[model samples]
Target: MEQLFFILLALLTLSAALMVVTTRNLLHAAFWLILVFFGIAGFFILLHAEFLAVVQVLIYIGAISTLIIFAIMLTRRIMDPQQPRFNSQWGLVGGLAALLFVVLAAVTTRVAWPTTSATLPAEPIKQLGADFVGVYAVPFEVASVLLVVAMIGAIIIARERG
Candidate 1:
């Protein structure tokens, strides 16, 4: 049952990710990206990392995805269907990406990775909270400020459009 669920979730994630890249409409692509983020949060839940899953949904789905949708809404030209999706150098970039994927696949298959199950710390959530407030407070606050600035900018642009 768990294996089946994992396979299904993996397929859903892969399909959503493909849609995110292939879809021409920026809004549709953003929605697909949200689905991909949800799939990742699902995987984190499956791995017994509830904190990480919640963080994924709150940060990626709630914050980041909302920001992306706002940006898409603000940028009118980005949704123009007449604009070419692929550039002249697409083929060269695609070839390089394919080659890199092949190399990474070969390297991953050749590795003898350990299959041992590791135990989690007794109070990981507490430690994480402490670290966030004590050590990582500056960066975390900076991120919050950045998000606020982006939202204000989006609103300003939208007001102009209106």
Candidate 2:
């Protein structure tokens, strides 16, 4: 069951990611990106990283994707139909992306992952909450501040010019 979930999540993630890159419409690409982010969160859940999965959904899918969609709507003029539909360098970009994927797969397969004798804790939610509010509190606050700043910057950039 877990293996099946993993396979499905992988396929969904890859398909959505491809759609994000290949789609000509900016709005459609942003929607596909949301799917990709959600699929990644599902993958994290399958890996037993519930905290990461929640953060991925909250931060990427909830916040970032919303922001991206808003930006696309606010900057619709840039995506005017008169503009050329396809980038000329797509072939080169695709070749480089494929090469990078092959290299990463080869390296990952060659590396020996670390072994652990301790069993995974049952209450991951409690542990994650403690860690976030204790040791990681400062970074978490900083990230929130960064997100606020980014939102403000986006608003400023998207404001109509006189």
Candidate 3:
């Protein structure tokens, strides 16, 4: 059952990711990227990392995807659908990509993966919550403030020239 879900999720994620790259419409590609982000959150759920799943959905799906879509929408004139998708150097790029893939595959296969048989913490969520609120509270709040400032800056920048 788990394997089936993993396979299906992998296929969905990969397909969406491929669509993100292959789609001629930039907006459509952004939507596909959202699907890809959701698929990643699904993977975190399947791994029993509930907090990670929620964060993935919140940070990637909610924040990043929204930002990307907003950026795409803001530059409306730039995403001309009739424009040619591929550049003249596409063939050279493809050859380099293929070579990189082969090298990465060979390196990965040759590496020795270390496996751990250790058990997970019984109340990991509670521990995480305590750690966050206790030790990481200040940093977390700082990050939130920075993100809010960045978002406001983006909004101002994205506003149409009057």
Candidate 4:
């Protein structure tokens, strides 16, 4: 059952990721990206990381996707259907992507990996809260500020569009 679920989730995630890159429609691509994020959250849930799963949904699907949607809405004029999706940089971009893929694959194959199962803390939620407030406080606050900035920027752009 778990294997089947994982395979299905992997397929869905890959399909959504491919759609995100291939779809010319910005809105459609954003929606597909949401699906990809959802699949990532599902993976976290499957790995028994409930805390991570909730954060993934809340941060990625709720916040980031919302931001992307807002940006899409604000930039309505640039989404011209008649515009060419692939520009003259297509060959260079494709070569760079291929090169990156090769490098990543080589690194992956060269690395010695451990196959041990993850052991979660007794109180994961509490530990997570403690970490956020104690160790990761600065980074967390920085992310919050970044989100606020992005929201403000989006609003500013949208207002200018009107």
What lDDT score goes with residue 56 in model 2? 96
Q: Which stretches of candidate 3 lie over 4 Å from their true place?
A: 133-162
Q: Any idea what lDDT model 2 has?
A: 0.88
Better of 2 and 4 by TM-score: 2
- Candidate scoring better on TM-score of 3 and 4: 3
Query: Looking at candidate 2, what is the lDDT of residue 129?
Result: 82
RMSD to native, candidate 3: 2.6
Could you tell which candidate, 2 or 3, scores higher by lDDT? 3
Clashes of each: 0, 0, 0, 0
lDDT of each: 0.91, 0.88, 0.90, 0.90
| TM-score: model 4 vs. ground truth | 0.80
User: How many clashing pairs in candidate 1?
Assistant: 0
Q: What digit string (tens of lDDT, one per residue) describes model 3 on residues 35-146?
A: 9989999999988898899999898988888988988898798699888778999889978988998999999999998989988889989999898889999998898999
- Per residue, candidate 1 scores C-alpha lDDT tens digits across 39-73 of 99999999988999999999999989998998899
By TM-score, rank the candidates, best first: 2, 3, 4, 1
Best by TM-score: 2
lDDT of 4 by residue, 88-150 (tens): 898899899989999999999999988778676699889888999999999999999998998
Q: Which lDDT tens digits does candidate 2 get at residues 1-162?
A: 888888888998999898998787889999999899889888887788988989998989888889889888977896776776668987898899999999999999999989799999989889878988999999999989998998899779867798
